[model samples]
Target: MFQPLAELPPPALGEREWLLECHCARPVTDLLKAQGWDVVADLDCNVHCSSPDRRVYVGLLPESQEAARGELWHIHVTDNSGTRTWRQTFGADTPAQAIAGFLAALIAFPARYCTCA
Candidate 1:
């Protein structure tokens, strides 16, 4: 059984380093899966999770893209017609603990009124 999001242990420094370099998506993907999101992984090891109105993507992106420079995490919520209504990104140097905290909060609350959702 999956552990509750609030109870999940934060990833250690070494683990975070490994995840950043290897693009391992299990940690985040598993948490999203437990929250009823559908997850898919590509050959490049990028992970994508989607719910009815939201999508989360985690990957090692090329630094060349202006929006993706130093950012590996991407999240967005879309409208019924598929237009993105909200979006956020986290930089490469962001701590795993911070990411976990954000995700925990996100899971605990509904996204209806919040831009961070």
Candidate 2:
């Protein structure tokens, strides 16, 4: 059985969990997977989305599931891009704190040579 690890606490008001990443940072994705996050699906981030870049991501499944109803998340990182985006599912009380932490870590660049836009 897989166990959930201590992570960026759930957003203060939502149902999503967030973690930031940067071009040079080693994403905690593997760590999450080790805990319980499963890659349920692959994604084409550039397909019909406002994002101009392309990326391959794996969908994350939460530790909890209610009749197959749960949240999904995706993460991707590129070197020298200076930016990383975290797409997650949030409910009425979005995990704003965790999300903010994720944003802070995701946007932190070596020298401000990247962006999400």
Candidate 3:
């Protein structure tokens, strides 16, 4: 059984629950999967999703330099030539619902246009 971080109450001080909150990726991954994206998780449990020209990552390690400082969500779109066209990141304390809101907007956005433009 998978439990989403959004449904959990706030963690108590020093609980260290945040360390294991990678489950926060579930809703985001599910959303991408339902939208015909390919979803996969690495051995470390980081979730990656990809469409034809876009990619999304959830629960990336804080130690990863590619990840924003302490960020859990990383999303990007690429051109047909594989150049990055758009990108966004959200920090560790960001709620799953908030990440979902951003992802929903991205998914709803037309792929033929550049959101960054």
Candidate 4:
């Protein structure tokens, strides 16, 4: 069953920025946001280990179905706009609980950042 976004624990990383790395992207995004931090953007890739095809992406704004890439990450995991900065790029499907916990910490302590979607 999908973990309801609203039920997502408060940011686990004790910060506001998070990078969702998983096959189940949207749902995870929902869960993180439910914790309090807003999702600025996401990027799904076609493969791992940076390629010319490798590029920073924004999944939060998928223009169409073609936007679904294999690997994804938040454009600015560490938005320095605020007091703190976050940066992370990793593989998805990282055990739900661990991810949830990381996100919770981030939410509890957030820095200044743009209002990304």
Q: What is the C-alpha lDDT of each candidate?
A: 0.62, 0.37, 0.66, 0.42
TM-score of candidate 3 against the unseen true structure: 0.64
Where model 2 places Cα greater than 4 Å from the true spot, the runs are 1-71, 80-94, 111-117
The sequence of per-residue lDDT tens digits that candidate 4 reaches over residues 19-91 is 4444544554565556443445325322212111222122332333434452233333422233224445333
| Best-to-worst TM-score order | 3, 1, 4, 2
lDDT of 1 at 81: 70
Tens digit per residue, CA lDDT, model 1, 48-70? 67763454443333333633566
Candidate number with greatest lDDT:
3
Choose 1 or 4, whichever is better by lDDT: 1
Q: Residue 60: error of model 1 in Å?
A: 6.1
lDDT of 3 by residue, 1-117 (tens): 677999877867887444323436766767777888788777776777777445443344544665555655777766667777777777777766667767788668766867688
TM-score of 4: 0.34
- RMSD of every candidate to native, in Å, equals 7.1, 16.5, 8.3, 13.0
Pairs clashing in candidate 3? none
For model 3 the local lDDT of residue 84 reads 74
- Candidate 4 has its poorest 10 consecutive residues by lDDT at 47-56
C-alpha lDDT of candidate 3 relative to the true structure: 0.66
Highest TM-score against the true fold, candidate: 3
Q: Indicate whether candidate 1 or candidate 3 has the larger TM-score.
A: 3
Clashes of 1: 0
